[model samples]
Target chain A: MKGRSRGKVVARFGLLAALALILSWLESLVPAFFAAPGMKLGLTNLVVLVALYRMGDRAALGVNLLRILLAALLFGNGYSLAYSLAGGLLSGAAMILLKRCGRFHMTAVSVAGGLMHNVGQILTAMLLLDTWQLAGYLPVLWIGGMAAGLIIGLLGAELTRRLPPELFD
Target chain B: MEAKRKRFGRNDLLLVAGLLLLGVALTLALGVNRRDGREVVVRVDGEIVARLSLSEERELPIEIDGRIANRLQIADGAVRMIEADCPDKLCVRKGAVRYVGDGIVCLPHRVVVEVAGEDELGLDAVAG
Candidate 1:
């Protein structure tokens, strides 16, 4: 039983990682209409949130980090890797904290995560370029992040509701 | 488990509403305080290459290492990237920026074009 459960865990992790990678690739195919360069649908985050709720923080962190690294290697460069690492790590941490608090639902947690991700990216940009001028871009980013976060959160909540609880156990 | 069944509770509604309100407030505040930029500063590899007045209407081709990389145009109290050799052409697609703090950056070419001038709200102070 122990061996079977371990295999199941590995299989689940592999499936989630592949799904997240595909979602990330799909998001890249969609051209960004916004003025900001890094803005996107953040579709892969849906998988991260699902992993966080189902398999706990360790699983979520593993899935999130693996997805960013895989996506970076497959389709991006060093700059994209930096941005994704900063954004994904900060957002994942925020989501985990919010989830633990248990005061709000997945939507709210996801919203906060989305906002923090943008903040992390912007901060990274500021550090790389050595300019405070980038802060001017925050208002637009905030608005965009909020809208994207709300949508992702709603979708994540719905997906979590439909999944079998015993599958993760 | 019962709580998971409810998609959104009062806290969720409050959080969403609060975030929306904050976004709108920030947008309005930033929009109102934005001032027309007096100069367009172009940088290559983080070094200042040129400073052009927004009042002047002209096109300047930027060269990096003896190779033309980007074309910058200043007209009608605004600045824009008209052309770039970069594959993505993100800088060209950014359109025109008239506000004091607006910037157009081409990461591939390491080129940055930003507006610099006096504004009612000091972004530097806020960011600092």
Candidate 2:
């Protein structure tokens, strides 16, 4: 039974990681509606949030990291990899902490995660360029992040509601 | 585990609402305070390479490490990146920036063209 459950866990994480990679690719295919250069819908984050809730933090982190590396290798460069890694890790940490607090729902946690993701990316840009001029873009990015987060969070809530509870257990 | 099962509630609603309000407020504040910048400053690797008045219309080729990487065009009291050798050309696509805090950044080349001088709102310092 132990071995079977371990295998099941691995398979589940693998599936989630695959889903994340596909979502990232899809996002890239779509024309950016926002004016900002790095703005994204963060579709892969939905999978990370699902993993965080259904499987565990370790699984979520595993899926997030794997998805980032795989997506970067496939469609992004070293600079993009740095930005995504920083954003993904920081956003994941924020979500985990907010979820643990138990005061807010997945929607709120996801919103914070989205905002922190942008913040992380901006910080990475500033660090790499060695200037704070990029900081001017933060407010616009913040608003975009919050809006995307709200949408993703609502979708996450709906998904959680419709999925079989046993899967999460 | 049981705690994780709880659904969205009033606190969540309040948190979302508060964030929404904050987002709107920041947007409005930034928008309202924006003013046309007087000069355009081009920098490479964080060093100021050139500073030109926006009132003058001209095209400036930006060279980094002894190679021409970008072209800055200032016309009609606005500045823009009309050309860039970068793969994505994102800086060129950013279009014209006229406001004091507006900027165009080419990440690949590590080049930044930013507006400067009076009417500065000090947003970057506060936010950074």
In candidate 1, the residue pairs with backbone N, CA or C atoms under 3 Å apart (3 or more residues apart, or in different chains) clash, namely none
TM-score of 1: 0.88
Clashes of each: 0, 0
Computed on C-alphas against the true complex, the DockQ of each candidate is: 0.48, 0.45
Worst 10 residues of 2 chain A by lDDT: A1-10
Leading candidate by lDDT: 1
lDDT string, candidate 1, B36-110, tens digits: 888887877667788788899999999987999899998899998999986668789988999887788876777
- Chain B alone vs. reference chain B, TM-score for every model: 0.75, 0.78
Candidate 1 Cα outliers beyond 4 Å, as residue runs: A1-4, B28-32, B64-66, B118-128
lDDT of 2: 0.83
Candidate 2 per-residue lDDT, tens place, B16-73, comes to 7887787778667656757778988787877778878999999999987788889999
Q: Candidate 1 lDDT, tens digit per residue, A32-139?
A: 667676787699999999999888999999999999999999999998899899999999999999889898989889998898888899888877776656776788
TM-scores for candidates 1 onward, in order: 0.88, 0.83
Kindly report the docking quality category of candidate 1: acceptable
Candidate 2 clashes between residue pairs 3 or more apart in a chain or in different chains: none
What's the true lDDT of residue B60 in model 2? 98
